[model samples]
Target: MRARSHSPRKPKPNSVMGSPKMKSKSKSPQKKHRAVINQLDYLNSQCHMEGCSVSIVVHSTRFLICRHQLCHASDYFKDLLQSKYGSEDFYVTVSSMSEPTPSTQFRWFVESSIPCPALKDISDETLETCMRLSRRFDAKGLEMRCTKFIVENACSRQPIVALCWLNWALKHKFDAQTQASCLPSVARLSLTALEQHRHMLTEKIFSDLLAAKLRGTYDKAVQVFRAIHRMDHFSVEVDRCPRCGRTRDGMRVKVNADPCRKQIGCDRCHRESCEIENKAGDDLQAFYQCPHGLVPLNSTTDECHCQIPNLAHHLGSRYYFRSENGTILNPPPLSPHTSRTFDPAEDTSERPGTSYKRQTSRDMDRREQRQSAVVVRLEMLVVSLQPEESVRRAEIVSFGSSVILSIAFFYIFTMLNAFTTTNIALLDKSSGCFEKKISKYYGQPKKLWERFSRAVSLCSPRLHSVELGAFANTDEFKVPLLAPSEDCVVLSLGIGKDVKAERRMRDRMSQCVFIGADPVNESNADLFSQVGKFYNVAVGHKNGSFRSYVLEDVYRYQEVAYMDLATFIKLNVNRKIVDQMMMDVEHAEYPVLPFLEKGGELSQRDIAINIEIHRPTSEDLQAFVGFLRRNSLSQQWIFINSEIHPFFKHIRLFMINGQNKECRRRFWEN
Candidate 1:
């Protein structure tokens, strides 16, 4: 290694700087102009700014100025002046002063550089013009002073002026502080004030007003819920015992008073009555009065009724019921168990100024508030929580909400697959592969038989059968229905990319008419082309374009087109009766099946549905099976082998019009 000298390199003659490390002053025209403009303008006359290239013309009056002074107020002016004329020899013209509306504003803004009272004691119109100019130039000091003065004097004295200013600021998208300062007071404006000054509101202010009104309505609703919850009883049907689901009967039995002894025609009673009457005349003593006032005694048995229990007394009762029209009907008692009855006359007389719409005592408005809480509202919950626990609570709420949403989605998905999917859990080799079968696991399984035991316990639909006995199959997929041949019209919705099932059915039933529907336009065109008269549409319960979400192996969701099944069938199928329709429209089976059942469309034809279910639990399957049974349709299921898909499984459900009660499979103690 050689020793190195620690000396700097020598500068070249061409380079003004000694080295790259050495600092040099490279004076561009912009720097020279900026240096001159940096000096404070003390004199009002243009003669003071000597050697100026730019001439600022305000309303035909020309004021010669250095280019740097014109650019000093804002970067916008600086960029404008520099970019307008690149040459330093030519005079650049400033034209903002030429406009009639902005001429005075421009003069004031230009003069504001030196501390002066140019803005003092001006008309609101002039001040507004000055403020606009300040905003245009982004002069923060002028804008702040204008805002402070206007808000303190003009806005404070006349709120309409405040609204006007706010409206202006919002229209031009001015300083947020100015706009925000006006919002709270504007929001607090009474309806009377709003109506009176309604003309002052621009589109932007109107939108803000609408948003504020919505927020206020929401806040009021929350407050009402909190208030009602605190009361001993609410008109809502949520007032039930936390521990038990039962409600006490409103009416209590009253014991009849003992038959009056005075009615007896005895001489002793007459003598006692005469003596009591005579003693009343002689002795008159003061008696204490009841604090509650004298209550009128009920003479008749009918009038001696006891108070009834309020709906709140029934916490866990299923008061809500869906009608045939799909509306939820909660027929709670008309009168709520308030300590004070809602005397409309008295309420109106006392609160004379309050309109009927503003009355909180009305029960109609409170109907939606039923079952709004398990404990309390989220606002209350947050307030009651500790600061440290708040974070934990938020995390819990977020996680819990996500979980609930996931569960709800899963449930909806399950219900959707209810009608379309088939059961084959108990289908043996003897039962044709296409036939749906129900689990015949009435007997308890031995622990040694793990798979069978698990299948018997978990896979069996009987657990839910008791709840819906009317719909449960008396037997497995053992209904005595002959297999379809030439007379059959088969419609299969959502044939997979393979089209294995559709091809097999078409091949087996050569004389039958086959129609298949799928909406994978690009990739599955070839597969769908293989089937007879396949349509590029999805089958849902109704007639519309539905978005089908497909979860791919790559962990991404792809959406496809979905069409209504009824409309497709009506358009495509010539035969009145569809012998078998295999539906594999993912979770779409939920709405489709219900639609069929609800409209009695299932009964119109002898259709056997062999649909593939997507991820249905035992409960879901049971509900589905029950739905089939309720429709007087015999249902069978074919379970998807777990080997094919690790997580997702399919079911092939079969439905027929008649029942086979005699074929009911039962467990006899062996």
Candidate 2:
């Protein structure tokens, strides 16, 4: 069969095997098909090269990526390549994904030559996807890049976007820095907007936002009140030339004594007779000298009636005036000058010499008239400068607005109070304990209930209370109206991320010494150390090593040293009587308070304590009350932090030593 058929098939011109045209036509179709495949399978065409070692399949889309390149770029890929199935091709299938999908993001991330992907051209949706994927795969570099971009770009421009980012970050438990950067924008959102997006925020964050809004409103009200109150009733005294009794504008007569001199002589009389003239003839003058260096009028002219200058005509001239406080006034008053029509028929024709004297006398009378006019103008100016009826009305409106805002704030504060659902028995004042039986107490045993009831009944009376730290996270205390001594000492325990209260205290009492302590050393040292000494130790029940979790971000923990209240006081404060003690030790207050009470450390000093009780149970409350009673501490102020927990989770209590005579004399008696 081979001997018969080998050379016989090449006869036709259109045959694909023999003709060049036929061969070219067949290749053209194949080329077009390949181009279509390359366009449709873009990922494979770009990534499926000779060096590629792994195949990543995202929603049935295959991407052949270089193993070393991808592993170096992503921690997820690094681990995946070292896994059991790493020797074979790897597949990642993401279902039900949106645009700028996981596969596309992965490709972009892998191909990115720069340390961080360029965010300019990337849409927010694409960036969000990158953030999500980076977080899932532990791509720390990409994660940080995305966080920085969102915070710096999105946060600064659009507050709503920033709020969204904040909600997302908070939900995912992002770093504290990221959350803090987004907080300002979130704080700017209106109550309505916040309510609309309330579902997106945590309860704690929502409460904080509301508090911030309230604080802003309060601040604006205070500013308006201050502005209204600062308005003064100003009066101006017009300065006049002693000789001619004329103002600067009316005394426009130049002297010929010296070209460089500002000495002004009377135009009618050639000699300088004003009080501003130098007696030594040195041309030295006072600041109140006449603007045109005018000389005095003739002495014979007893009542010269000089024409008063128009207020607008003297716009370029300087007029000296004194305020009611005896200070020089700038931009002198604009009251209209009084004018009188001259009677031309009053004086008859006279001899030449007598006419000169009569004319000079007439000019003097005109000058006197000008002086009277200036006086009338000054009086009008004083009346005009005084608060007008409209201004008074505006003031009333402002005060009314402030009062309304204050009432609104109070209403909100009271309405937001979330008390425990458990009913507390009434306190028996005589016995200093609850009337209900121990069995009736909610969830507590008999002994615990008795102690709790007794503690609850023991109320620490307050004489005077004042709120310090006007802004967010303020502190209330029983402070004396009189300023403390320069050697005053303040102890701040558990100084977490907030130093606003401390900073305010420092501003009020600059000479007082502040000492702060906290377990987390990250930013506490930098923040607290700016105003006072900072110690990296937790205030607890005992002095030893302990593990403490960060309050701002609960996921983070720190191995820190712990010091009891007494030990901390003795060591850091040099055993000095603490003037003010601020304690916010999360839940450690339960044990630390009892320990301090047992050790009699609080009783030994006349201390003003500002303490925050966190997540207190009925037993804890009883113990706290008992501790205060035993220490003879009077509760000066109390606030429930609804932001942390809606149901009495955090209680801020301020107390002062009632037994200490000095404390009573300093704060309560005053």
Best by TM-score: 2
Cand. 1 TM to true fold = 0.26
lDDT of 1 by residue, 216-303 (tens): 7645654554344335221223333322333447732221111222232222223343322222211211122344343322211121
Q: Rate the local accuracy (lDDT) of all candidates.
A: 0.48, 0.56
TM-scores for every predicted model: 0.26, 0.36
Please give the range of 10 consecutive residues that has the lowest summed lDDT in model 1.
466-475
Write model 2 residue lDDT over 538-616, tens digit each, in one string: 8888889888755656536667788887888887888457777788887788887754453456664635676666756
Candidate 1 regions off by >4 Å?
1-485, 551-560, 617-649, 659-670
Please give the distance, in angstroms, between residue 433's alpha carbon in candidate 2 and its true position after superposition: 16
Query: Could you tell me the C-alpha RMSD of candidate 1 in Å?
Result: 33.2
